[model samples]
Target: MSFEILFLVIYFVAMAGIGVWAMKRGKQDAEGFLLGGRSLGPGVTALRLQSSSMSGYMFIGAGSMGYTQGYFSMWYALGDLGGGILNLSVLGRRMRKLSQILGSITSIEYLEHRYPSKWIRLIAAPVALFCMFFYVLAQFIAGGRGLEMVSGVSFPVALAIAIGVIVLYTFLGGYLAVAYTDFVQAIIMVVGMVWILVATLMAVGGFTKGNEAVGEINPNLLTMWGADLGYQGQWGVILGALLVFSIGYMGWPHVVVSHMAMKKPSVARTAGVYSLIFNLLFIPGPYLVGMFALILLPNLANPETAIFEVADAVLPTFAVGIVMAAIMAAIMSTADALLLQAGTIASQDIYARFINRKMNDAQMVWVSRITVLALAIIGYAIAAFDPPAVAAVVIFSTTVLGSAFVPSYICAVWWKKANAVGAISSMIAGTLVSVLWQVSGAPDATGIDPMVTGILASTAAMIIGSLASQKSHPVPEHIGRALDETAKIGPIPKKMLIDQDALLASQAEMAGRHE
Candidate 1:
């Protein structure tokens, strides 16, 4: 068999094996299926978070941007770092506590509790569905693209295979499967990226020659920061792009679900540290790889295809197949996570909470699986449109999530005075305003990013209206209890690790409550 086909078969078997293992645990019920019974360890959480966070965009979109933009792309990496710091320091602990308090199996569940409005939950369900649906589609498209690019196969056949693998693993194991697969995929992604990065250094003849070649192409590309050769770029534009992309980190359904899946909320502290370090290495990958391409493959027509160009240039055929599988790993890791989260939220928060409260765990799990299949199909259909541009789709999805949910999520953890009236109002206003801002051709609109405007406006509405309508919600007792629980951050020993018996006991309590 061809190396590409061989690699594909190996990857499929590995993913399926993970799914089978995870399904054993998933048989427990909704919590098992969605949050892995809140038993994910620090390493698993860190790997899953990083893999899901670095999506198709990082490999294809960010790579393409770096090819043209050079060191300016590093701003995106820095911005993501900044966002991670914010998530861990400001929102991370609180989110863990809150999810436990509200019995929130998903992010939208937390949203419904904070707002206490069925209407807000209703609005959020479809929005989450839409964003994740497109997000999954983008991943499938990238997966198919990777297959075609590596194997020289037709796009349709490649797409079908990509979608098939993702659905098989995801439908079988749910979040449990996604988490373990994410661990493996994260390692593969890092290795593949580092391999290409090393080859890029060699291809460009070293850092100094790389800089010289970039300068030869366009002096601006060699600088630490600047706009595009044409007027399409700016320092502000780059900063805005990076900020919008990364600030939404905590709000994306997949990423936030990682937070919810933590076995111990304190594990987040350790996971946060590891994630920060790993992201630093991975985020700069595209920028460096793309810059190398500028030096070696300047005439390459499609900048997004530059990573593959470099891979084919340096690696042997089998190695190229491995790299292709690794890229698909990145794509599937994110797609499965998002698909599971969306399906979970749809069944539990939307269908169970609003549409069908009497639905049993078995029924909910079935619905969640169906939702996953439906979303995968939708994403595949969208990817069939074959958008060559990566930045646009990525930016649009992040912008919507960031604008709509980020502010409310922040308030839920921080602002005690925040109420349902404020939460519901802000989500609608922020999402609508952001959508309108984009519709108004605001991506090119001067200095401010659309998110900046939408977030600011929605925040004002939430704060002012919350203050004005003090009687709208009495803060849940669980919120206070969870906060009190978190306030007692126990002293860390010289060697710290979770006590499994105590962890299992706590999980049993959560399960009992669910029952």
Candidate 2:
């Protein structure tokens, strides 16, 4: 085998080995399988969150944007960089505290507990699954294309191999495996990205020369408004580009589950700091490399392949293998997370909650695994035959998911009166508005993006829906108490905000106090 192929084999073997080890550690309990028993440390949590959040979108989609749109793509990167910090700071600590207090293993379960509604899971679960499927589909595309390039295999064979590896690791180890593997992948992603950036810069004689070359080809490519000045004076599109990734990820169910998997509530503070550091190192590299590729490989037919093509073009034989692994790392890290979350919802929220209420922990674990396998098959089929634009799929799904859930998720911990009606209404309205806005091409006509309009409609729906129904559907007393304790961060005696390490006495004390 060539060094590239050999290196890829070694990388795949290592990932599967980690899955086996993690399986032994995590065991088969529902909590262990689904949430890693909430034992992730700050560093692990931070990198895992970032790795899963960036996904193939950063590797393929972001590069494509930069290759085509030039410096304008930087707006999305800025939003993405800020989004990580914002997610950790805004939802991190409180979400960790509240989800545990409510005994939620899944993000959807947390919504049901906080809002106190069966309908919440019934409706929310499907919406989440639908949105996440699109996200995972993007991964499948990126992975297949990456594998096809590296292995020189047909697309079908490459896609199956890629999917198989992701599913195996996720199937064996569950959340613990995914988290640790994500940490490893996050390091690889940044290193590979920086490697390509350095090589590209050297080839082009540095950033200044690269820009000058791009300018000579077309001065518009050097402009922040995008090639041909496509977005000039379109401040609405500009704001949307910045806001979409920055605030949008806060609403992603797959991403926020990292908050629930944290070892403790206080970990969020350190995780936020870690995120800031990682973002600065990694976020801008892909876009910068993509723009540089415009000068180097101007005739590149597939813009999404800019980074991969750059690595292949610039790196030596062994180093090329390393970059290929990094691209796979980007794809697999997020693919596993999406698979796990979708499976968790399918099994815990729908199968157990609705189909078989009395199932035990072991049964739940099996159901989750089975659900994951089923999803992989369906996702593979869709990806193989009718692939949509990876970037478009990611943006559309994330926009809708963020719009649908951001208001409800933020309100869950922060607002006392955020009733089920409000959450449900917000989810429905946000999804509809975002979809309609995208489908109807209202964003094109109005010069505003779907994210801005969808979030606005959803936020309004939440406030109006909750206030109008306060008398009819007040926040349950139990959840209200949990929210209060979650909010009351200071003055708690012992191991900080209602610690998990403490004995059952504290829990009972709160129960008695409530009664």
Candidate 3:
């Protein structure tokens, strides 16, 4: 076998080995399977969360945007750098404490506890699951494209192989396998991308020469504005890009779920610092490679393949295999997490909580695994038949999820007056406005990104709804007490705490009395 094939074989075997190891050693209970027993240390938590947040979009879509739009595309990275910090600072510690206090293993479950409304859980679960399915489909498309490019296999066969591997590991090992593999994959991604960037820069005679060469073709390629030199450089467009990734982190289920799984609230501080450093190193390299591709493969037909094309042209066969594996790592890391989130929502939130409240730990575990497999197949099928533009799919899914959850998520932890009515209205309004904006071509017409509209609308709805319903839908006293206790900085005191068991028992008592 060629060195590339050999490297891939080793890579695939290593991933499967991790899965088997996790299955044997990792926790098998529902909480352990889904949330890693809330025992993840700072380093693992940081790497896993950062890796899961970034998909192939960082390498493929971001690179392509750089190649097509030039320096203007860097705005996305600028936004993301601050976004990681914001997510950790604002939601990380608080959410971790609240989820544990409320005994919420999933984001939807967290919302249910925070709002204490069946309608909120029902609405949030399906919406999150649907958006996450599309996000997984985008990753499948990215994997298929990478596999096809590197192996010269047909797209369908490549897609099948990609999905098969992801499903096997994720199905068998669950969250533990996903987190550990993500830690490994995160290293590979940074090292590989940095390698490709350095080699390409050296080959093209460094940044100065590369820019000159690109300038010769079109000077606009080096400008803050894109080649269009018009609306693309507008402030609204840039602001939208910045806000989407930066503030949007709060709403992402797969990303924010990491907060709920950490070993301690303090882990958020350590993980935040580490994740910020990782983002700084990882986000810029691909976009730089995209710009470098301008000189290296100027005539390349598809800009999105800039990173792959550059790597294949410059790296040795064995090194090429490693780079390809890194790309696979990027794609699969996020895919596994997304699939896991979808499964957790379906089985834990929808099935166990709503449909069959009597499910034991073992039964829930099996249901979760089966749900993971089913969702993977569905995502794979969508990718196999007719995949939309990967960038468009990613942005849409991210925007929808961000719009639906950001306002409510932030308010649940911070705003004492935020009731179920406010949270539900914000979610519905955000989703609806975002979809309508996209369908109406408002972004194209007005040069404002849909995310901006969605976020603004959602925020407005939250404030307005909460104020309007203050008299009719008062915040529950227990919830207010829990929030007050959790808002403190230090570790929660055992004496002052209302543990999950007590809370559940009290809720049951209230239900019995009402009935």
Which has the greatest lDDT? Answer: 2
Per-residue lDDT of 89-161 in model 3, one digit per residue for the tens?
Answer: 5365566556656777667878888998899988998888888887888887788877777777888898898
- TM accuracy, model 2: 0.86
The TM-scores, one per candidate, come to 0.84, 0.86, 0.85
Residue 241 C-alpha lDDT in model 1: 62
Q: What's the candidate order when arranged by decreasing lDDT?
A: 2, 3, 1
Write one digit per residue (lDDT tens) for candidate 2, span 220-302: 87778989897999888888788788778777875554333434555555566677888898888899888888888999988
Between candidates 2 and 3, the one scoring higher on TM-score is 2
Model 2 worst lDDT run, 10 consecutive residues: 497-506
Pick by TM-score: which candidate is best?
Answer: 2
Query: Which lDDT value does model 1 have at 138?
Result: 74
Better structure of 1 and 2 per lDDT: 2
TM-score-based ranking: 2, 3, 1
Global CA lDDT computed for model 2 = 0.80
| Residue 293 displacement (Å), model 1 | 1.0
Lowest lDDT 10-residue stretch of candidate 1: 497-506
